[model samples]
Every structure is written in structure tokens, then in C-alpha cells.
Target: MMAMTQLQSGDRAKIVDLSRVSELVRRRLLDMGVTEGVEVCLKCTMPLGGPFMIESCGQCLGIRRSEAMRIQVERV
Candidate 1:
């Protein structure tokens, strides 16, 4: 498994763990259909350490790089 931050734009991966994330952030992720077992595609990473845009369950969500660093995924 690798951190979500490690994925390149257009890469697809399956979520493995969100254990390192805070409850508030985890809840937000869940509300956006991002959870373990879900397949997500890295749409793009904003320039200069900005947020990352990911597509999960057909929805696009932008998340902070810090949060992305805590999400674990396996390339699909």
C-alpha cells in the first residue's frame, strides 16, 4: 500500500486504510463515498503542494495534501 499523495494524476487505486486520519476528516471522506475498498482515481494534484482532486464513486472531491498523506491505497 502507498499514500494517496504518491499517486500520479490519472492513477487509479483501491482505498486500503484511513486509520491515520482524524475523525472529522474521516467523516468528511465517508460522506463523499471515500472509504476502504472503494476505488478512487487521482484526477490531479494542484501545483506547489496544494490539494489533490480525486474521483470516487463518480464524484470528484478535493482533499488536502496532508489528508492525502494519511490515506493508504493500492494501485489498481
Candidate 2:
């Protein structure tokens, strides 16, 4: 498994773990359909270490770099 932040644009992965992040972040992710077993794709990454744009469950979300660092994912 690797941190979500490690994924480059166009990379596809499945969420495996969300335990490393705080409960608030976990809750928000879950609510956004970013739970374990869900497939996610790196859509876009801003320059200068900005938020990452990922697509999951037919929705796109921009997550902070800090939260992305804590999300674990396996390549699919």
C-alpha cells in the first residue's frame, strides 16, 4: 500500500486504509464515498503542493495534501 499523495495524475488505486488520519478527516472521507474498497483515480494535482483532485464513486473531490498523505491505497 502507498499513500494517496504518492499517486501521480492518471494513477488508479483502491482505498485500503484510512486509519492514519484523524476522526474528522475519516468521517469526511467516508461521507464523500472515499471508504475502503472504493476505487479512486488521481485526476489533477496543483502545482506548489496544493490539494489533490481525485475521482471516486463518480464524484471528484479535492483533498488537502496532509489528508492525502494519510490515506493508504493499493494500485488497481
Candidate 3:
């Protein structure tokens, strides 16, 4: 298992667990369709450490570092 934020571009992973920080943060990610057992791909990262793009469920989503840190994934 690895942190989603640590994945390199083009790598694929499956969401396994979420950080035990707060329900609000966890719910926010779930609302965006980032749930456990879902497959996600690291597409690209914006220059200058901005939000990174991930592909999942036929949609591409941009997530910031703070948000990404709350998600844990396993390489696939």
C-alpha cells in the first residue's frame, strides 16, 4: 500500500483506505466518487505543485495535495 500523493504520473492504483482524520474530509472525497475498492490512475500533475489529475470511473478529476494526502492506495 502507498499514499496516493506518492504515485508517479501514469501509475495505476486502487483505493484501499482513507486517512482517519475527519468525517468531513472523508465525505468530501466520497462525494467526488473516490471510494474504497475503486480503481484510479494518476494522469498528470500541474507544474509548480498545483493540483494533480486522476482518472477514475470515466472521468478525470483534479485534486490538491491536501486532499490527496487523505487517500491511501495500492499499486495495481
Candidate 4:
């Protein structure tokens, strides 16, 4: 598994694991349909190394760089 932050725009991957983040964060991600085995795509990232736009389960989310690094993914 690799950190989601390593992915570039247009990259596709399947969620492998979520880091040992807080319960609230885990719940929030799960609520948003970000779970293991789900495929997600990196749509784009903000300039100056900011948030990342990721698409998953027909929903688009702008996740902060720090949070995104906690999401581990494998190339699909």
C-alpha cells in the first residue's frame, strides 16, 4: 500500500488501508464512502501544495494533504 499523496492527477487506485487516524476522521471518511476495496481517482491538486481533489463512488472530495497522506492505496 502507498500513501494517496503519492498519486498524481488522473491516477487511479483502490483503497487498501486508512492510517490509524482519529475516530471522527475514520467515521467521516467511511460516511463519504471511502473504504477498503473502493476505487478512487486523483482528479487534481491545488497549487502551492495544498488540498487534493479526489473522486470516489460518484462523489468528489477535496481532501487536505495531511489527511490524504493517511489514506493508503494500491494501483488498480
Task: Specify the highest-TM-score model's number.
Answer: 1
Most accurate candidate by lDDT: 1
1-76, model 1: which lDDT tens digit per residue?
9999999999999999999998999999998878999999999999999999999888999989999999999999
State each model's CA lDDT, in order.
0.94, 0.91, 0.84, 0.87
Worst 10 residues of 1 by lDDT: 27-36
TM-score of each: 0.96, 0.93, 0.82, 0.89
Where does candidate 3 stray beyond 4 Å? 21-25
Ranking by lDDT: 1, 2, 4, 3
What would the C-alpha RMSD of candidate 1 be, to one decimal place?
0.6
* Candidate 4 C-alpha lDDT tens digits along 1-74: 89999998999999998855566777887899888899999999998979999999889988788888888899
Model 3: how far is 8 from its true place, Å?
1.0
Candidate 2: segments with Cα more than 4 A from true spot:
none
Q: Report the C-alpha lDDT of model 2 over 1-76, residue by residue, as the tens digit.
A: 9999889899999999988888988888889978999999999988898999999878998888988999999999
Pick the winner on lDDT between candidates 2 and 3: 2
| Position 19, candidate 4: lDDT | 59
User: How many clashing residue pairs appear in each of the predictions shown?
Assistant: 0, 0, 0, 0
Per-residue lDDT over 1-76 for candidate 3, one digit per residue giving the tens place of the 0 to 100 score: 8788899999999999875536876776688887899999999988887887999988888878767776889999
Total backbone collisions, model 1: 0
The residue pairs that clash in candidate 1, if any, are none
Off by over 4 Å in 1: none
